[model samples]
Target: MSLRRILKSWVERYFSDEEALILLLVLIAGFAAVIWFGRMLAPFFTALVIAFLLQGVVSALTRRGIPHLLSVIVVFLGFVGVLLALAFILLPLIWDQLIGLVQETPRMFASGQNWLDELQSRYPNLITPDQMQNWIGVASREISQLGQRALTLSLASLGNLLSLIIYLVLVPILVFFMLKDREALVGFTLSLLPQKRALMARIWREMDDQIANYIRGKFIEIIIVGTVSFITFSFFKLPYTALLAVLVGFSVLVPYIGAAVVTLPVAAVAGFQFGLSESFVYVLVAYGVIQALDGNVLAPVLFSETNNIHPVSVIVAVLFFGGIWGFWGVFFAIPLATLLKALVHAWPRGMKGRDERHHALASEESMEESL
Candidate 1:
């Protein structure tokens, strides 16, 4: 084919499917809106996500003969209870530990400096004493700056306490109504669309199930892994158990990267507390077992092969969406990537010609039947 014909064919091949075009346009618009107004719409998005996560629970309760409204109310109350517990109970404990750690910062720095000095003594040519001292100086200065920045940010957050309160109030209300009026919302959304929406419907159904399962699975995984880590660390008398446990728990979210990155803190805490003793070895072994069980047992039980996405793809999705939406993006990267994959597979190829012929045949058949 000529270059012009080739260009025309390519454009027609991709754009000829009206439903595909519509889906693409809608995705682009939605993405643009999020990028433009992410902060302003964060609460609504968060509420929507919470509603989606709780939907299965609501359905389960309704199936057990509870009324739909009652199910929603129960779930909403349970959610609020959990949030209150975290805010008042769990957070205070974590914060106290954090303050303790900060107060012990000088000891940590001294220990680190001693280790560096030992290294310099062993390998005099590799790391000079002056270089070690300079490195320590830089790190100390950086830590000071970091502490100041953290305090400043905390103060800033306090200033935005009203905004946080608004979110706390508004989100639950949105989630409650969303769960209660889900069918009506779905119907109203569908009513705005064209009648011919088979492809869109199929894609929507697939994405709905995939996203829901993924979110629920991750939630369970975090709780299980974090609890296990906390118990294991506590048994070993490790300091900062809560902080480390939280890291280890959420680390499961990023697959390979999360575990590897979180290992550092666990190791550092263990080494600092017990040096090369058997307690350190025991702590490491316990952590290894936890990770192994999480990967082999808990994950298989909770998540299915539906998340059979390639490792490379998962990493790329992490980078891409994480860049766009930070933590939330990283949290949702895999499911979002799966949605894109489904869309690509579902998009019709050579649809224009097929649709035209099918409509023509239907028109002729109708006329003959009328006659």
Candidate 2:
């Protein structure tokens, strides 16, 4: 076939209906809005996510014979309670531990430096003086940089306090109304779209349940992993237990990468406190067991309903979306990846279905003419 004919055939196969074209435009517009207005509407987005998380609880409560408004109210109050605990209780502990960790950095570095010195002396042939100097220089520079960044963060946080206040005031209101008026809000949103939305409906049906299950499962995993990590660290008498536990908990957000990255701090804290002793070994072994169980058992059970996405695809999605939207990107990486897969699967099915209908119509016309 000629290039023009090939192009025409491909377009006909892919974009045979206005639904396909409209969906493409909607996706492009949605992405552009996020890229442009995401930061400005962060509070809205955050509230939206919080509402999504709580909606499941509200639904469950309603299913259990509670009134819808009562369920929403109960769930909202619980959300507020959790937020208060984080803000007033858990946060303060984490913050204190973080500050303590920063203050203890110099002492940790000194111990590390002493260990390196002893290693150099014992392995003089293997550890050249130049290499030793280079290593020390690198460590010194890194510690210095960490201190500088911490200082900068402290200063920036003051400016962010106002922003935080806005979120505090606005987010709850938005979340409450969102829950209370969810059906109306959804109806309004749907009204904005074309009446003929069979393809869109198909994609939404798949994504809505999939994304909800993924988010709920993920939060549960984070809580379970983080709580377990905290208990384990406390058992080992590890310093900065709260801080390290928070890291370990949030690390579940990035799948393989999160666990690996958090391990450094856990091991460093263990090694610093107990050196090459059995305590350090035990802590490390315990951490390994936690990770193994999480990956092999907890994750599978929680995410059984989610699509069987490839590991490489998951990693790539994390990197891609994380680069695009940072924390939220990383947070929603898997769901976003699932959405992409849904779109890919949905669009082809839509086109083929439309093609079949068109052929059927043509055949009917031929039969009528023959009659």
Best by TM-score: 2
Query: Which model scores highest in lDDT?
Result: 2
Worst 10 residues of 2 by lDDT: 348-357
Q: Number of clashes in every candidate structure?
A: 0, 0
Candidate 1: C-alpha lDDT = 0.87
* Candidate 2, 208-229: lDDT as tens digits: 9888888889899999999999
RMSD, one per candidate, in order: 4.1, 4.2
- For candidate 2, list the clashing residue pairs, or say none: none
The true-versus-predicted C-alpha distance at residue 232 of model 1, in Å, is 0.5
Q: Residue by residue across 1-371, what tens digits does model 1's lDDT show?
A: 79999998887887787777787887898889988998889899999888888999999999999999999889989999998998788888888887877777778778778888888888999998789879998989977997897788788977678887898799988988899999999899999887877677878888888899888999999999999999989888899999889899999999888898898878877878887689989998999999999989998788785658888999999989999999888998998899889977767666665486468669989999999
What is the TM-score of each predicted model, taking all chains together? 0.89, 0.93
Predicted candidate 1, C-alpha RMSD = 4.1
